[model samples]
Target: MGVRRVAKGVGDLLIETLGEAVAEVILNLVACALLGCLALIACLCWSFSPRLTIAGAGLFSCLLAHGAWHTVRNPPKGRRRGLAALTAVAFTSTAMTALFLLLYATGCDCL
Candidate 1:
């Protein structure tokens, strides 16, 4: 009973942390895309910027697009692994953009 309880506790901890990390990675991707849009909005100004937000939605939409393009361009033997990698990298970058935007929105930097 004691060993089983300990094992259960350890399993629970591993699952919780790993699950959170995975979720963070996914959200980070979406957040980065959203944040990039916000930053670009600030830097370029709406008048100067056009179609960029749509284009910069790299976290989700961009990933899918790039993935499709790579798959089509390369015609993967089994699967478009290159697209998957590119999409993942793009997601991470977009997440970075999102985190920055979140900070900007909250004005946490000043604090």
Candidate 2:
């Protein structure tokens, strides 16, 4: 009876853990995709109007926030490296855009 209970407990643990693992993978992939899209949009919107650039970046930022929230809600799954690369690229693009706009607005008067 003792051996049977131990085996049954192990099986239950495996089932629950596998389900959580699968969920973790799905959530991570979704997050990765959102980050990738943000990076892509940021790259392409360099020459776009300030309003559109800001709007696009804002939308992606929200998506990223959502993904981040989920990641935090379920701790234990490791972060994917690709997400970091995507975020970095997006941030670079967004910063450059903002800098360019600021310079344009100020007429780069320092020059």
Candidate 3:
């Protein structure tokens, strides 16, 4: 009976840990998707004005570089590497979107 209880306890712990990990993953993915959308909107806004577009492009480039650095710095061991890449991409896209938005709001003509 004691052995059975111990086995059940271990199984419960494993299940809880797995659940937490899965929840974290889901949250990360959602955040990334939101960032992508923001970046896309900034890109669209850039089309209306060249100066703003240049600024937006700069932001996009920065994000790309950052993402590349992240991927290179953290070599993925297995399935987690893919997740890390996705996270980086999401972060970069969101940053670009934010930069473009700032440019538009600032009204700075010189890029």
List of clashing residue pairs for candidate 2: none
Each prediction's whole-model lDDT (CA): 0.63, 0.63, 0.67
lDDT of 3 by residue, 1-111 (tens): 999999999999999999999976665555566556656887778767879878877876676776767755855565545645766876666667667555443433222
The residue pairs found clashing in candidate 1 are 28-95, 31-98, 32-94, 32-98
The candidate that achieves the highest lDDT relative to the unseen native structure: 3
lDDT for position 94 in model 1: 57
Instruction: Write down the lDDT that model 3 would get.
Output: 0.67
List model 2 lDDT by residue over 1-111, tens digit each.
999999999999999999999976665555455555656776778766778888876888875665555444654457535665465556566656556444443332222
Give the per-residue lDDT digits (tens) of candidate 1, residues 4-111. Answer: 999999999999999999976666665566656656665675456546644564445867667555544655467535558777566566566556667544433322
- Once all C-alphas are superposed, what RMSD does model 1 give against the true structure? 9.3
Worst 10 residues of 1 by lDDT: 102-111
Clashing residue pairs found in predicted model 3: none
TM-score to true structure, per model: 0.38, 0.42, 0.42
